[model samples]
Target: MKVSRLVALLIRRSPFRAMMLAALIAVCSVVFSLVSELSRVSTEGLDAAIFQDNGYLGTYSVSLAGVPLTIEDQFDVVDRAAESLDMSVWRYSEVLPEVESECPPFDQVGRRSLQVMWERPGVPAELDFGHIEGVNAEWCIDGQSIPKDALFAPSSDEEAIYGAQLYIDPAYANLVALSTTDPITYGFYVVSGREDDQVDALRFAVLDEVASLAEASGYAPSVVIGRVDSAEVNVRDAADGIALVYDLIRWGVLLLAGLALMTVQMLSARQRGWFQGLLIALGAGRARVVALVALDTAIVAVAGLVLAVITLGALSDPVASFAEQSLQVQARSLSATSLVPLGFGIASVAAIAAVGPALMVVRRDPLAVLEAPRD
Candidate 1:
């Protein structure tokens, strides 16, 4: 059949009907697209919430030879572990041997007393710790636990002993000059920011690396990895529940949108029963008629998809703004990968919906179709 003839038939069938189908497709397409994007955003939000509410997940304590690993040692171990895992590892260490009385509380020194226990000595200068929060710092280890931005700056001449608190803590001035020639680091926590799916694998991998390091250092069976407490489990469960809700919503919306689109296409084809019969009676082959019906549906489907793409492009900024303000997640921009699902979904529904209508038109004899009531 010629393209011109197919178009004429479409025009005769009422452009409004085609327009309506296209509009439905466009709307459904956009709905699913937004749902997909929102799924990703909601996931990100959930991850953020989990990290905030479940601090235990990100922080792990380590002990070597029955002794709490020092921040200096922790850095070496974590650096090696990070290289092995090809991921980042954070340090949040507590200053060794809390001395509240001998050291005279940080407040007496006229400095803001941070209750930070972990002292990350010799942390990489280039490493950014901006994502971490709620690191409590103490007078003895004021600038170690906080993010890199508030990190203590030591002069080039003192860089060799910078991690030793040789200059930062006046209280530790004597310790640096006397019994402790090296930097003092006590108990610390190791943190890793990984996706939910990778948590278990990464945890085991880190433990393995820690164990390997322990064995090499002759501290075998003496290194202990921290376990998540009941409170941490509860928080993790809540975060998981939020993720489950998002999954249900995303799939539910897609399912409904698909059903609506299929129904519309079926009804549209069934409504054109008279026109189909007329074409057949006028000597149009059943194959030609079926092809035309399929082509018609395809045209509408394609138009709707294009319209949806245009509409989504125009609304991207507004949607992103709303997502940021209401959802508190950085909205991901649309990409070709993201559009793939939408395309496949629309195409699948259109093909399936067209099947029923095409079968109905093909099975009936032209004479019977013409004689039968329009209803």
Candidate 2:
């Protein structure tokens, strides 16, 4: 029988089973490809957040190596680094509980208050909010000091900011024109998530750079870097998570590809023994006979791969967009280069599986198989 005819018959024997395996392969391919692309993009954005120590609000904690927090001595270096890295340096408000600062509490600052929508009046608002919407509610700070509490509708007016001590994001800091040394305390904690990890490395690099700069500037200063309770994430944790997930996916899909396709192919091969025996009887070489099976497997694999590619195209954007919104980071476009290895691997497995049964078929005797005299 011709190779094309054999392949057609092989497929016709169990079309749905073949299609089901193909679909499974496609689902695996799409998932792996999408995850790989997301990881690459997430890594890129997170790397900058780790090194620069500002922007991307989800960053659990930022590590500053050296140069001291809120110190005017290293302002030049900090400024230069900020310029070079194209990053904004954030200064934490020193107004912690029981700490007195000359630079008025955020409550004393120009109109910083919380606004929210309530069905009725007199719903006691929580003094401190875990949500940003708390910025709109009226709260009594300290004793008998309800700083400018008014029941007005939510408007985009600047008067909404009626509180005294808000976390000094870059914009708020700039608006106040506060000096770094004006008791406007900055908290530059060394984030050592993993000992000797990337996060630690970034912190060390910062320390080294500042030390070198201080020495060069003819100032051998005593600088101490300490840790604070900042409940933020380090980039290394994310990397570990991605690696663990990838490993799980790779093994799971490999098992599916092997068991599903290989088993189906083996069952189908049983029905084609007469056809294969005919080929060998008609002077077809073992290599040629095996090629026929490989070609048939290739056809199925190609179909699966195409389905996978199409599914990936359809899902990648939506998944990426969801991640970007959910995680609050830039979800870059999927990279084409990531698929090369995956495609090659799928093809290799299909070829190997096809050749397994072909080897058996090529050695069988056509006339004896047809006679069925021996079990």
Cα lDDT tens digits for candidate 2, 1-375: 677887787789778977887887777676667666665665676555444443233211232333343344444443344344333333322222222222333335444422231111223223223333335433333222222233222222211222223332222222233222232333332222333333343344445557766666665544333333222455556756776676677646655775677777776666677767777677886677787778878888888888887776676678768877897665533456866866886786687568657767766777877766433
Q: Give the per-residue lDDT of model 1 (tens digit) for 1-375.
A: 684587567756688877887888888778777777877776666665554445435444544443346556656665565456554445443333222212333335442212122344533233222211333333333322222343343333332222223112223333322333343433334554432333454446656656755666666444445532113566567767876776676556555655665676567667777877888899887878778767777787888889989998888898889878986766754668778888887777668656766787789788887898875
- Best candidate per TM-score, number? 1
C-alpha TM-score for every candidate: 0.58, 0.48
- Residue clash pairs of candidate 1: 93-118, 93-119, 94-117, 94-118, 95-117, 116-136, 116-137
Off by over 4 Å in 1: 2-8, 35-40, 56-59, 66-221, 228-251, 274-291, 320-338, 361-375
